[model samples]
Target: MKEMILMTPGPTMVPEEVKKVAGAQPLHHRTEEFYELFSNLNKNLKEIFKTKNEVITLTSSGTGGMEAVIANLFSTGDKVLVASIGYFGERFYDIAKAYGLDAELQDFGWGNAVDPNVLEDKLRNGNYKALLVTHNETSTGVTNNVKEIAKIADRYGVAVIVDAVSSLGGIPLEMDEWGIDAVITCSQKCLMSPPGLSFVALSERAWKMAETSNLPKYYFNLKKAREGVLKPNPDTPATPAVSTIMAVAKATNMLLEFGLDNVYKRQATYGKRVREYVKSLGLELLPEEDIASDLITAIKVPEKYKASEIINHMKEKHGVLITGGQGPLKGKIIRIGHMGYVTEEMLTKTLEALKDAIKE
Candidate 1:
């Protein structure tokens, strides 16, 4: 039997150990055993988020975390400055609008990172109650300088909400030290786990925002979630995805055991190797070198070639599944993912397959 390699940005390859947990018999969310698992998961989540604040787990995809941030941290008519560079950053703008918030977007080019100087100017001049940004723009393979942006936002006394969906465990971010108010991530990207769980962490300032936010929400209500989790037993506000939570528990343990710094180093090294190998094939990168993400690499397709040609050929002929570009980039580029359980051997094979596919 041949193995299928996932080279997409997410719903990334899961580890066998984590898969084993997800495949196990389901447990009731109310049980003592489940509480213990949930507790340990939250503890590890705080470490992964690099925050001392309580990390909340929701039984939804990464978007749920982003939505939760908007739902709980700001009221309707309250203004937010969305620093948008790519698809996911645009998503932040969309989310804000969906909630009836006054969202002013600072649009950078799709293939570039957000300029901190530009962000600083906006924060200093705008009357925004919050600054929303994506830590990693998965669509463009660009990573923003959240630490610097947070510093600038902090100086302006604006709350910083970050979408760390694809970068959290694979990249380095310090939520507490950098004064990030809200951070969002998911199980499928860098956690080496299957999809269906999203994590949200809030700083003290963010919690304070939640206290006054009047945005209408139910399942994604962060205040309700905090109330439940802050209890002595600590539980989710809703009936949790028991199996997925168990799987994430195993995955987070594995990441911690590997050491967070070492895990980040591995992902960065793999990302660099992918970039170098793709460039050697005369492929150009979408993002600037300084802003390129350490979890995924977006390569521009040659003028005469279609991204689907290489992507479909690799999947059909070699069982290597990489993804094509999104939104405006569809058919113009291909993205190679190096996060989670992706290995060097798999990347080498993927590169070889891509090379052959391109020649065809």
Candidate 2:
């Protein structure tokens, strides 16, 4: 098989140390040894999120963590104002309705940020139980205006749940400073590790609601996770992702060693480089320049060509890998992730391959 370089937004090129750690042997969840791992995991997760709150680690991917947040913090008929900007945002609404929540979706066009004025107006109505939104809408490579949304949610006394799945470490996230009640993320994406580990940074307010929200919950319950994660022994309600946790420890430590400021700067700079390169290629960008995500850049495919054709050419001919758009934007956009192990060389090579592939 041809060795490939993964440039997709998710399951990004994992670091060598991360892959090494992921190969470590598993352990029993109830043991003190495991608890020790869990303790460190929670501590560093807090550091990465730039929060004082404890983080709940789930055995599943980011979706499981999102679902747990919905189940434990919201109940049937509870009014929720959700911001829909991309594929993941739609899933938030889907979860809300599936669990019987009164979901009022406020939509922004794909690749566009939600209007803060509109959110403020909606919150002024003062009728929501919670305000749920994604910090970085992964599907569209657009980062939402989370701080503004948090301010709006606070004015209404509605609990705020943010899906930081792609923004946590790659971006500077001040959960408490922004007044975010619940911010959930995944190990994949900008964390620069493999999937199967989903984390939630919780405010005291979020936990209070989780304790008495009367929502049915089990394995992924935040309160239960808090108990296990806080103890000296690290364990989950289900079997923990031992390898993933080990990989996370390395990944987080690497982030700190590199210094978060540097990491975030690199993310921003790398993305800007790609965006500039894409534009020079005569292609349009999807998200507004100021609102684009540092984790990935979504470039509009030309009308004369198919996005998949270019993607296949890059993969088969140039050994480069990127992603096509999801949902309505499919076949019209190509996503290039500059996060994780991505280097300037990779972007340059990928761009060269893209140029070659698009040559008529």
Candidate 3:
């Protein structure tokens, strides 16, 4: 069978080194060798998260990391505001509501970024405990101004929790510098690794909130996670995805070796090139150019064409797999993911396939 290139918004293409490590024998989580690997992984994750906090690894998808934040940070009946720009943002609000928190959703429309001014206005009028936001909205390919949003939340004394699942490694997020309280990310996106691992880091303030949080939690208990990591031989409370961790450990070191700045530049370049080429095809973008994501591009499906037809043709005919929109925007847009181990040659091939898919 021919190998298909992944242009969907994650589980992205993995590097050969990462694949090799992942395919190798799994490690015993309790062994000293695994401890060393886990310790180094945590250190590298801190560098990637740009925080001094302990970055806890979980054995679940990115949604687990998001749920952990809600379970550990705030108690039942705590008032929080969810600022949503797209599907994942709504997911955050849904998680909070399920946890029985008094969550209010402030929708900024699907294709737009969260307006910091509008956020400030809401926070000024409400006494909320925390403000949940998504750094990159993958559904509509919009990157919110998290830095500015964090500043506004801080003035209102609301803890800022960010869902950075698809954006963390691809985009620059200064967890400490921006005063963000908590951030959640996953391995299958820009980390250049496989699925099954999600990571979360907390600010000092977030940890303090955890100490007082009365929410019910066991498996997603971050305090237990922290305790396990703080031990002499670091480990997770439960058995982790040992192979996935191995792969991510290798993949992250590769990123550090390449330099984070260069990775950001490369991702930005790919995004710009893809957007430009799509426009050259006389296509429209779902989001405005200024707020477009650097990790993915959401192109509006041209009139008289179905999104599924374009996606299926790209994959079945050309072996290039892109994705359609989610939630309300489904069937209206197609997303091209350019994060994690994507090269100019690969992108060129995918774009050519896309052009042919749309034209023919």
The best candidate by TM-score is 3
Tens digits of per-residue lDDT for model 1, 1-360: 787899888889988888898999988988888888888988899999998888989989999889988999889899999999989988889999999999998999889988878888889899789999999888989999999898898898999999999999888999999999999999999998988999999999889888898988899988788887887788987898899999999999999999999998887888888888888888899998899998889989989998888888999999989998988999898998888888778888999998898789
Which number leads on lDDT?
3
lDDT of each: 0.89, 0.85, 0.94
* Of candidates 3 and 2, the better by lDDT: 3
Cα lDDT for residue 273, model 1? Answer: 85
Q: Count backbone clashes in candidate 3.
A: 0
Pull out the clashing pairs in model 1.
none
RMSD of 1: 1.0
Off by over 4 Å in 1: none
lDDT, candidate 3, 134-161, per-residue tens: 9999999999999999999989899999
Model 3, stretches more than 4 Å misplaced? none
Task: Give each model's clash number.
Answer: 0, 4, 0
